[model samples]
Structures are given as C-alpha cells and as structure tokens.
Target chain A: MSADNLTRTQRDDLRTIAAMIVPASDAYKVPGADDPAIQADMLATLGRDTKLVAAALDHLARLAGGPFAELDANRREAVAQEFRKVGGAAAATLVRVVLQCYYRDDRVLRSLGLELRAPFPKGHVLPDGDWSLLDPVKARGGTLRRAP
Target chain B: MKDPVDVLIIGAGASGAAVAWSLAETKMHILCLEQGGWMNPAEYPSTGRDWEAKFYGEWSSSPNVRGRPEDYPINDDNSPIKVVNYNAVGGSTVMYTAHWPRLHPSDFKVKTLDGVADDWPIDYDALTPFFEENDRIMGTSGLSGDPLSPLTHPPMPQQPMGLSGAIVGKAMNKLGWHWWPSDTTVATMDYEGRARCINLGHCTPACAQGAKSSTDITYWPHAIRAGVELRTHCRVREITTDENGMASGVVYYDKDGVEQFQPAHVVIIACNGVGTPRLLLNSKSNRFPNGLANSSGLVGKNLMFHPYAQIYGYVEEPTDSNRAPPTCLWSKEWYDTDLSRGFVRGYGVQFVRGAGPVFEAVVSEQKGILPWGEDHHRVFRKLNGHRLGFSAICEDLPEEHNQVTLDPVLKDSHGIPAPKIDYTISENSRKMMEHALARGREVLETAGATDICINSPIPWGGWHLLGTARMGTDPNRSVVNEWGRAHDVKNLFIVDGSIFVTSGGVNPTSTIQALALYIADQMKQRLANLFD
Candidate 1:
C-alpha cells in the first residue's frame, strides 16, 4: 500500500508531521518536505514505506490523546518522542523515505548546487592541477624494500 | 558447448577474463562460464538521474543486498566486514573505483620480513614483467617515479586530480608524507581503443562512461574476437572429476535453469576466493570424500579482507560535486609497517572526492545530524558538496580461523550452496586503523577540513576478497601451489585472489591480473609437464 491509500485525516497528520520533520527554512531558500508539490511527490513514491507512515500517524494520534494534526507543537513533539521510543525502526524508515523524496526533488537538488541530470555522456570536466606540486616528494626520492 | 573442450574456465570475472585472454593466443578452444550476463553501458545507473540511489538497490556492492539473479548470495552475517562483488563479465571490476596500485616487493616475503603470513612462491620481481604487460592491457593511467614500486611508467598520463585532490596533495606535501598521483585503470588518454574518461563522478556500481577498465570492455571483447567463447548466465554448481582424480568438466545451471555439463582437458577455477572454494568443496566424490583437491584441507582457509576506514570532513571551499573519479591521489606514508604502532602491515590512504547530492543526504540522515524541520536544510547544506576525505585500506593478515565455508542452509537460485564468511578484525588491524585515523585526521585538518568525522573500520567495506586458497609450496598448508595449480588435482588450477599469500595494503587488481597472466604463461610453458 502507498500513501495515496491513506485517508484525508491520516494524510493531514502525515503532512503536519512531515513539516515538523523538515519545516521550510528562509536562509536555506528551501521549502519544507510537506510543501504541497513535495508532499504530493513523496506520497506518490511511498511504495514500501506506506505502512510505516500510516503506523507513525496512528501511533502519534494515540500518544497525543487526540488528532496529531490538532495537537499543539509541544504536545505533538512530545508524542513523536514517545512514538519514536516505541517505533524506532519505523520512524527511521519514515525519515528515510521523506529525505529520499525531498533530496530527489529538482528544486531541492538545485539548492544543493546540483543539477538533476544523469552523470553520463555529458560528464563534467575536472580542472587539471599543476604537476609541479610533486617536486618536493621527488626530491626526497625513496625506493621499494626489495625482497631477497 | 564443446563435448571435450581444451580448457574450461569457471567464472568470467577478473582473473578468468585475463587468463582467458592470455590463453587465447594458443587458440586451443578456450571457454569461460560466467554467472552474470554482459553489462549494457546504456542501462547502467549513471545514465539515469537516480544513480546514487541505485547503490542501495540493484547495483549494490553487496550481493546479499543487490539480490540480482546473476548474483549468488554470500552469507556474511557472521563477518564484520561484508563481502562485496559484482557477478558479471567483469565481476567486481564492474563496480570498482579503478584505484590501481601494485604490491610492493616486501609484500611477497611476508614471512621473512614480518614473520606473519607465509611467503609467496612468486615474488614481485618475477611478476613485474606481467604487471607491465597487464598495465598496458588494462589501459593503466599513471606517472612513473613513485619510489614505492619498481620504477616504470604506465601507458597513459596520470588522471586529472581536480582542486579537491590538489588541496589534499598540498596538505600531504606540507606534512612531508609520501603522497603521489594514484595509478588508476580509468582511461586518461586514447592509448587503447577506449577514449579519455569523461569524469562520470562515481565509477562504482557501474561506469556508464566506459572509461574504467572493467575487463568487460578491456579483455572480453579482444578475448571473444580471438575465438574465446564466454557463455553467460551459466552458474557452475560443482567441478566434475575423472576416474584419475583430474578435473574433467563441470555441471552448471544454464540461462534457462537447465542442468548442463561441459567437459574439458584442463579446468581453471577463477571464481574468486569464495566461489572457488565453494565449487571445490561441493565437488565431493568417492575417491576424494572430503572434496576435490582436499588432500591439503586448506581450500577455504585464511580469509583476508582489506577492511577500510573513512575519515572525512567538510571543507570550507566549494569542492567539485563528485565531477571526477572517486579516488584521486593516494598516500603510502603509513604503508610501511612500523612495529611500534602495533601492526605488522600498514594501509594505503585513498584520497577521495566528495559524495554526490543523494549520497550526501543519505549519509547525513544516517548520521542523525540532518534533523527534520528547520535544521534539516541547514545541516544538509553544511555536509553536501564541500566534503573531502580519505579511506584507509588496512592490510588484513591471514588467519586460519577467518574462513569461507559452504553454508548448509542457504543456496543460490540454482540450488548451489552459498559460501558463508566468518571474519574478524585482529588486534593488529585495530591498532593500524587507530594510527590511520590519527594521521588521516591530521591530513584532512591540514587540507582545511573542520569537524573531522572518523568512521573507523567502515563495515560493508570488504571490497578486496583474498587469501582463501593461499599459494605456498607446502601441500599441507596451501591450496594452490607456486604457479596457481592445485596440489591434489593436477589438471585443476585456482587463479584469482584465492591464491594470494598475503593481502597487501593496496588495490590487488594490478597484482591479480599480473598473476593471472603469469599463471597462464606458466601453463603454456609447462604444457608437456603441466600435470606433473
């Protein structure tokens, strides 16, 4: 099952949590993981991590004693802490899924100073360095420990 | 398939390809059986935007992780250092950094100098000519005068080390350490048929640019053209022996999962350290109840791995976004063993370029520094492209306890038993790594990298698989004799890293291919008395 199978309430809880995980930053000039376009992309590509995402949402709601989305920021974070203690592996998977989707985003890649393109055919040209840097090492001149 | 072939080699990997190519000169109906098919460069992950992600999936270095049909799983749960190999026409060379470095002369006489592992029957001086021959064949990119090995230049000029490499080079110079341009197999010039490397950033997983010499592009084509037949998707189950206890042929699962047998006069096993022993051990008979060539009983003993440690830091300057080869310059500064450091053998420091964007993000997430929310972007930015580091390939000594044995439970797709690895880092290796970390941190800090991170002994860094079937004159202690021939089975030859006496502190491909060529020459020279 994918994140697309999640109900509206479950999706809202996930978006709220995702934003908390990686909220928008003004200095970095990057949107949060729960940014509309990124959220849609993440949901579409949550192939194997859908169950874990759903589990995290359900557990966070239970820990918060109400809807995780409706919980205050402090309560939600406290609930997330408790949820992490209980669902450590699942939370990591959730984070990994979000990060993978987030970093793969073209805008995010650009922010990282990388163009979203294949590294073949038109591979980058590395600048050649001055070979004279090795003069000192050549001056010291050593030989192999020849075997008898 | 030839009913009675002249020579049948198992595993069309590193050593197999070299041996096949070298032996093809005689035109004696040479045939190699490869478990994996020919790699299509266009289909390689580098040709797609999701290249780094592919490292975790189908193109993973570990067969246990990749789980491709071509790859037979290795049971490495017991081992700290996981086994990593690509099962294709090129084998692990398909997913190698192409960091080429020849073994020092002292590496051959380990017992005499270090008083640890047994001395190799063949020395570096004997393999020097073959090394030169293989270098030319592999399109080796290097400069001459590096006082480390015997002085001889490679076919092509050194690979262009971008600014990041220069920073590390300047740092090494300041410290008065012995750092030099690495001898790599990546094409720097149009020496052979291949063009210059287009700097595909990452060479591992697969080199889509075809700049790296993976033997698939280097030896396979020439070997095929010279009448050597390579049957792909043929997983050899066991080596079949004749009444005289000679290797007759092999039973293998063909592409269609049909069991087939190919008979041959001479059988060469180049299935690497693990696969080689697995085949021999599985080939049990009434005459040899233990296994084929089990008179010595050291078929899969003395498993050696060059366990690695990565010490990295984020440089302040904008480094190349992995726009060049993975490895640049290398330092043999700590390569010579100093007994005061508590290690017999030392390690080679492989200066590395920064990780790609996806890789950076993944590593950041794993390190727990890239928190969710406001700090995520900030931390990711701090770690991404401005990273530069060094990997120390510590020379793991031979231990009889650390070995590869046929797993009783796990099996491949063809029902062939998988090789289970049981390896541990010795006290000597730990001490060597400790020294390496201190020295590496110094170099990186000198290179203007702050917040230095030391991941000592990176697990899942078992790239070099060696020392399983060791080479020695004694029949009791070793599997293959001096010239790559099995002691018990006359017609059976075990080439590949299995015959390494001592694992050196450098890349073994240069030495591996050289040994392959040397063994092939030995076979050719002693054709009349080969079985003697």
Candidate 2:
C-alpha cells in the first residue's frame, strides 16, 4: 500500500520533516533513512491495497502536527523528535501497520531510486561457527534449523 | 486406538530438536509435535531494531519477559518467574544467543568432589565423543587448549570477533585465568549455504541470514527432508499407555482444542528441563500415579538453574564492543573451585561485548536512572561504545526443595497447569557469586577500567535449564538411566538438560546435544533388537 495519498502540500511537509531527522552532515548526509521521495517511488509498485499507504501517511501527519510541507527544518526535526519521545503504544502500533503497507509496495522504490530485488549485501551475524573439528565417526548432517 | 509411532517428540526447540536429529538414524517412526506455527527465513522476524515490537511483543527478550500487564499468569505486577518462551515450531531456538560451551568433566561428578549435589551416572569421558560430534553438526567455534576437548581434525575455521575479545583475553591472562574463544553455535564463516557472521546488531528474534545454528535452521529441516513429519500447533496433553505398560499413543488437543490421539510405540520427552517434567507430571496414568515414568518420584525434583551475576564496566573512550558479532571471548579458569575459599563449586565467567541503546537505557533505568529524556540520551550515547558487561554463571547445586510445582491456580491456553518455580539461592551459591564478583572486579582492574558497576546477583534464567529428570545409576533415585532411558520404562527416553545430574557453571546446549547423540547411538543399537 502507498503512504496515505498525501495532498501536494502534505507531501512537501513530509519531505521537509524527513530531511531533518538525518540532516546533511559532513560525515553522513542521509537525506532520510525512509524518505518520502523514495516512498513515492515505492508506492507505484504496490501489491496489496493502496489505501493502507494513505492511512500511514495520514497518521504520520496527525502525529507531526500541521501540514508536513509547512514545517521548517527545526519544526520537522521537532516533530520527528516528539514522535521518538511520545511514540508509545498508539504511535508505534499505527506506524507499524503503515510501514507494512509501504514495505509491500514495489513502485515506491523506483520513484525513490531504490532497488526492490537487491539483497542486503552485508551478511548477518549468526551464532554457529566451524563444524570441521568434529570427528568423522559421528558427524551428523542436517539442514540448519530456523524459526517456522 | 491405533498403535503409536515408536517415539513422539514435543516442543521442537534446541534440546528437543537435538534429541530428534540424534535419533534420526533409528528405524522407529518418530512423530515430532510443536505448539507453535512453522517459520521461514524469508518471513522470519525482520532485521530492524524495531522488529521485535511488531511480533506481539510478548516473545521479545526483556529484563522481565512475563508478558503484557494482563495477558497471562506471569506479568509485570506479580511473578518474578518471567516465563518468556515462544510457542512456535522451532520454539525459543528462533531467538537465542547461541553460546554453546560443553560442561567441564568435573561438573558431572560434583557430589563426589564437593560433597554437594548427586554425581551423574555417566561422566564427561562417556559424553566427550558425543560433544565432538555435536560441535561438527552445530558448527561450534573455539580453540583447542582445554585438556577436556578431543583433538580437532581441521581445527577452528574462524578467528574470534573484535577489540573486546583481545581486551578480555589480555585481562584473563593477566589474572592467570584460562581464556579461549567461546565455543559458540554462531556461524563464524559461511557454512551449509548460510552466510558468515556480519556484525549485525540483532541476534535474537531470528537471524536474518541463517547463520545462527538454531535447531530449526540446523536440524528440523533435515528431519523433515528425511521423511520426518512435523506437526505444529499440536499440544500433547497426555501419553496414554496400554495394559502391558507400554506407551500406545499420545492424546493431544489440536490448535482448535479438538481432542486427537497420535499412536506411537515409544515416546521421547525432550520438552526441555521445565516443560519435560511438567508434561510427565501432567501425563498421570494408572500404573504411574505420580506421572508417567515417574515411579521414582524424582521426575520433577532437584531442579537446578545456573545462577549468574552480570558486572558492567564503563570506560571514558569508545570501545568497539557492539560493532562486531556478540560474544567472542570467555574465561573458565575459575570453573573448578578450590573449596578452601569457602565456596563449594565455582563459576564460569564470560564477557559479553555490549548492549544496544534500548537495552542500555533499560538497565540504566532499572538502576533508578531516568529512562527517557536528555539524561537518558546522554548516558546512552556515552555507553554506546565504551561499555562492557561480564556474566558469571555459578554452579547451582540440585536441591529437592527448589522444584517446579504445578501452579494450582495458573493454566496455559491449552488448559494445562503452568509450572510454578519455587527457587531460592543456596548459601554455597551465594558465596560462589560473591567470589565471582570479586574475580570480575580483579579482571576490570587488570584491564585499567576505573568506572565499573557490579550488578547484584540474580536467579538464573535462559536456555540453560537442567537437572529435573536426572540420570543416575540407581533406579530409585533417578528418572532415567545412564543412557538417558527411563529406569522402569525401557522404550521411553529423555535426552536434554532434564537428564542432567549436576548443574554446571557453563551453558548446557553443547553438552545436552552431546548427550542426545550418545543416547541416540544407544537407541540405534537397541532398535535392531526391539523393532526388527
């Protein structure tokens, strides 16, 4: 699903808010970890209901206060900061449901210059290590178990 | 009712999966049942820091993992026995910190040496070969300096983690402590199509890449591929036996609470130390009034948990403690105690690298510090890198008083009595913790760490649950024999921490896996005579 179909004004407000969370620093100039521009691209490739996206953005905006586009860099940062602080059960629950909507959407990636099929290049830190030390007499072979 | 399969396995967790995999070679038809739904890596818990909050929150690891305010018998208000277990296919193996160290040889013979606890029917030598076998299958990481370990063929494949490892190693050496790379079940390098360890912040919930050697990733899949049928959301309520006193089948309630019976010739109870004993007690039959295979009245007695105390050290400069894979180094020099110091058994001291921001905040808050706000943020930022924690796992002697009694009031969703743990630290245990804290302080001093906070000792909790259905030489004193077979019931077998005769200072996963393999061999040899 796409983020709630933001009005042109609302969309701009969100963009402004997103940029402030991770400002243009000298070391790492992250426009936004989850940018609205990128999210627009993600919305186009949506598989499930598009209405879910609308719900997420609407909730995101409601918590931020006023239209996202009108907010200055400082105001946007304040909004993001407030969410981080007061994000309790309600905010988290809303954000979670909405993110799932956007996550399933594929079109949003192209709009935001992202790759849908790209793997997380870095591997995970797993707990098991080398099995080569085992004795050949009892080296039992089986597929590594995962949560089902 | 139709005849039951030769064996029925329950829980499908680390210990349970190990037992099933070990017994795979046996010709007996094994029916593995689980209380939770099956999971897949593609759909496993996400890699985000916020992922745990999405999955009902109850499954996540907390300082207190009982549940939400009013969800179950366990919650924030009342009980300290925070029962945080997953009710899914692979069970808690899905979310585990895979630190798998074998119990030292002395752990099994504690009673003989220290005059405390009962000596195991079988010693470390008997379980050594099986330990080696499990290391290979589970892909353990370690160096071969310990005399108890068997000679390695190809040796360890991966080196230990980061700067924290070197620092811990140096401190251990300075204190004349025996230090080594932890024998972890984490994939140090790529193995069995899974990727190698990449410094991910999250190891719990589930490994995003199938590197953690969780039983679901390592064994259950293989069991299924090898013609083993795994039924999920099926909870076995009782094991029904025939007039001949042989287990005929299991009576269970399906996920929908519909009563059903699955017949089996033999039954294997590998429901871990807590669940196994609880199940046995619930499975009250006519011949065995106390519980099935519990004629000795020792089925649910002598519960032991390796109580531990965590000590934290905070330094001024940044330490790359949380940058790499979790725990890399450990010291077991003090694992064997010299009772002249006034403590009975010793403790295994190991250092975990660091904690996440949220975890750090929670701990600091629990210390009566502000959890949220500028002060919390500032402290967390400072603790982000330079902080380190050491865990001291002390040996807990088996006491009949510290037992798992059924909560007359509490019941699970399946209408089964929940386990109520009545535990208190023994004086010997308290002394061991105190000694361990002092040793930890010495290590910090050796490392030149000035700001150190030693956490108060607490009751043990986690994957290492042992010593309920203990194995012994005598039929009257133990529930299982030396080979992990029930004394009175020949076909019934138990191979988990429940069969532990003594609680060791080390994590019992590797040791439990080894015992399962050893018992599996015994079952394989005997199957020829019984089945064919």
Candidate 3:
C-alpha cells in the first residue's frame, strides 16, 4: 500500500514510533522491533508509513514511553495505567482516533493479527437434518449450563 | 421421493427451524431446505476475543447467518430485506442478538387502541401456551418481575451478566422501575451436552463455547435426531402450485446453482420479513397473478423497524466495557400504556456496557474530540476508566407509509429485483422517542454518570425489521389468518417477523420463534388428518 509515500525522515520517525506503540512482551512480541523479520507482513500490508500510520505509532509510543524495544512489562503497563488515570471522556477519543488509523493501516492489522474486512469462511456443512436417521448420539436435556 | 413430504420447509432460520423442530416431534416426514452450507463447530467466532473481526469478514465468516451476498440479495435501494441473514444450518439464529421479550396483550389489538392497523386474528391469550413452550425450549433466562410474562414452571436457568445488569438493576431499583434479566436463549448450564457460555464476548456471529442456543446448536440437533432431513445451500426460488391452487412443490436454485424441483404437499416460507414477502411476490402462477398468498394486495405494506437511540455517558469507574456478550440488561419500565405522559404505547430502556478500549478510542477520536499529536495521547488516558452507554428502543406504530416494494430496475445475483424500501417514521414515533429520552436521562442521573451525552437521531437501519406481512382477523385487511396461514392459499404458510401485528419495544426473535412453533403445531395437526 506504500503509505502515501513517506520521506526518509518520516519513515525513520514512524519506525521509532511504531516500536514504542507496540512494546515487546514475553507473551507475544510486538510485530515490529529491531528484528527485521518481524512485522514484515504487517509492513507490506499496511503500506509502510503514512501520516495517519505515523500518528498511530507515535500515539502508542507516547503512551508507553521509550521505544517498545526498551520497555519491560512493568514499565509498559505503567504507561497503560496512565491511560486509565486520564478518565473515559478524553481517553475514549484518543483510542478511537488511533484505532481508525490503525485499522486502515495494514501494519496495525498484521500487528493485531487481523485482515482488512475479509469475507466469512465458505463451505459450511449444515446438518441434513438427518442426525437421528444417522444414529448420532442423542444428548437431549442439555440446556442446563450455567450462564457466563 | 415416492410420496412427497407433507411440508417442505425452506431456510432453517428462526421460523423455518422452529417449524421443522415442532413438526419433527409428531413423526411427520419433513424435509428442510437451506441455501447455505454447514458451519464448522471449531470455527465458531464467539469462542475467543478476536472474534470481533468476524463482523468485517466475508459473508460466510460473518457472525450473522445472512453472510453471503447470495443469501441476502436486495434490490437497488436496499429496501427489500435490507438486512443480512445467516445461511448455515441454524439460519439467522447464529447471529441474532438474543433479546427475547413477549408482545404485550394490547399489541394483538393495535387498531382498537391506536386507531390504526388491524387487530390480530388470534389474541395474546391464544399464543400464550406457545410462548411458554418457546421459553421452555429456548431456555429463556428471565426474572419473575414482569407480570406480563407469567412463566413459573421453567425458572430462568441462567443469571444475567455482572456489570451492566448490576448497574441497570441498581438504577432501576432506586427509581422504583421494573427490570429483569433479559430473556435470552444462551445456556446457563451444560444443558443437552452443549458447553456453557464461557462469556467469550461474541454472541452475534457464533457462540465460542457453545453456550448460546441458536437453532443449529439446540433445536436442529433434536429435530435431526427425530428423523428430519436438512439440505443446505439450496435457495428456494418460488412455490409451484397446481391448477387446484394447492402448492405442489417449490422450484429452487440448489447450492450448485442448478434449478431443482422440491415437490411437496405443503410449502412453508419462513425466510424472514424481507425474503418471505419477496418470495410471495415472485411466485406468480397461472391460477393467481398477484403472486402467492397476497390476495389482499398488502404483502409488503406496513413495514415497521423499531426506532432507537444510543445515549452514552462518561462515568468514573472502570465498567470493563470489553466483557463477553453484546447486549445484557433490558428495562420495560416505560413499556406500557403510560399515555398520561402524552404517548400512545410506551418504550423500553436497555442498558449495555460500551465498546472496548480500542473500539471506544476509535469512536471518540473520529469526533475529533482528540485530534492527533499530544491531544490524542491525552484522550487515551481519559478513556481507560470509563462507564458508558444505555440504548433506548422506542416502539414504532404500524404505518402504511413504511413499506417494502421490489425495485423496478435493479436485480440481485438471482435475477430478482432488489427490495426497495419506502419508509418514514410516523409522528407517533417522534413522540415515543421524546418520552424514552427523558426516562433515560433520569437513569443516568440516578447512576451518577457525569458528562452525559444523548445521541438519538431517528434510527436508520437494523435487522429488527417487522410488521410487513401482518396477521389480522379480517381477511380483507390482513394477509394471513389466525394461524399464520395465507388467507387465500390453503397450503402456503408465512411464519416470521412479517406476521407481527405491531412492533414491540423488545427483540422480536423470541416472539418470532414462538409464532413459528404455534403455526408449526397447527400445520402438524392439520397435516396428520390427511387420511381422515
């Protein structure tokens, strides 16, 4: 998607910003980092770095503080806790703007492990309504599960 | 194929599935035809947090049953059955927002009170038993608060969710308003071997842990076990009737797009509000010219979609907006004949937690309340701990102006013209909204929510479309008889939301399913007497 064609400085700044937005974690590493192999799929999908893409990266990084490469779990969370401290009215607005940009960016989709509006899976095999005829096990009276 | 089945059911959605399930118990030879393929149990989206993405995917991946373009093709204006329906074995049940509330007794006699629309052929009392049966079958998780719903034998097997329910409960209790656990089809326990709802947060597309009781997971299996045949990916085009005006069979496009004849003694059309009317209009035959079951020339008149407004609030506590289940608490506080305040029928107030942080942030950011740069960062900090949202559903009167007609030029993949909708909210609907907003404000005040924002501008579109092919007492006015049978056709039956006389303030699925059951029984008894 070639991110609206970013300048060299803008691209470097965006990479730095993305590094901060998607901080590293032992559970699941951020898509982009010092490792060139990671986030390559996302980068290809999202068109490198557009203005909105750059803004999203910057927003995530500013919230987390320092680049994602440098942050530990505790440090990364401390930054997220700051988001909560700000309250819903303002915080909701910020998240919405960044998500709008991220959702559009192929990189954010890859980072979050998502595609951009793919169709639902096909070839659903509806029961021929002949289960009893097929001698399937009957598990009647099974509507008694506890509500979540 | 030697002796045609008594009833060839098409589309195992709420209406078709329920009708088939009800008939299967009688040991009748039944064959249900569906246009979509089967669903993978493992691929059910509600199983995980990432399932939200399913809403954006292909029609097949869509959490809704009306997933593919072929399943939900509309005319140019997107008016005829404007909404998408699922096509799997369960039909539209898989993606339904499980908000089931019974119609008020007065809803049957709308013309008597509102001076518009005709009275139902059968009153609420007649349908009460079927409603009860529906509650039992669906495992409705409701409270004993509403006197309108007097089901005591089968208690609510499940309890409501935590945060949203509690908030509404507290607010309603404080104000002396009536509230209850929403009547839902989700399994509260491990009923019938289906896993309980793990509260995986996705109820629309697919139940992740098998808690939601969509027909495929619930009734379809039982019906299948009782010797019913469900053929998927077979789209029924029109019913072919004999010279005697009896529906002999249906000509349909099979899943492979081949034209196949599904001959049967009786044909039941439960395709839904939009599809049902379209099928009737399209089934033009030599014996009857104005399409099937539409002798009154009112097949697609009186289309009514419930008008609603979403009132959001910014609260102090962390409401955990990212919890499982899309909708939970419902309020019927104003769902009555409270005309003293100057409205005909009242509305219902349903409270639900707001969207997730990412989704929430995205919404707020679009408002430009948080522009990019440092301003965006500041907004994120604010949304972390926010309590928000209460959606108001106002009742819409049955007005003739709101109608669904076939498009003159535009056609879908099947060479059928799209359904064009000519709709306008009535003056009565405007008043209903005004009353609902005032009550919502009171709840927000009671809950101590700060910076309350009321955003309601006449609902545009939702799947809850109702009241096109209404049931009525007079054959001159209504299209169907007391049992949802065609006034003109002896063998054709229309069971779906289209038969609703008036649009209630709650979700219509429960009532639709109940009506399907009631009609199914009538068909069963009548069909059994073939040799008599």
TM-score of chain B of each: 0.98, 0.91, 0.91
lDDT of 2 by residue, A93-142 (tens): 33333333233334432332323431223532333333322222123222
Decreasing TM-score order of the candidates: 1, 3, 2
Highest lDDT: which candidate? Answer: 1
* Predictions: Cα RMSD each: 2.3, 9.2, 10.9
Task: Kindly report which residue stretches of model 1 are placed more than 4 angstroms away from their true locations once superposed.
Answer: A1-17, A43-71, A79-91
Worst 10 residues of 1 chain B by lDDT: B365-374
Give the top-scoring candidate (DockQ): 1
DockQ of every predicted complex: 0.66, 0.06, 0.05
Locate the minimum summed-lDDT window of 10 residues in model 3 chain A. Answer: A138-147
Q: Model 3 over residues B159-212: C-alpha lDDT tens digits?
A: 444555555556666776655556677765666667655555556666656667
Going through the candidates in order, what fraction of the true interface contacts does each contain? 0.80, 0.07, 0.04
- Which regions in candidate 2 have their CA more than 4 angstroms from the true location? A1-148, B1-3, B43-46, B52-56, B62-84, B147-156, B369-377, B458-460, B528-532
Candidate 1: docking tier: medium
Docking class of 3: incorrect
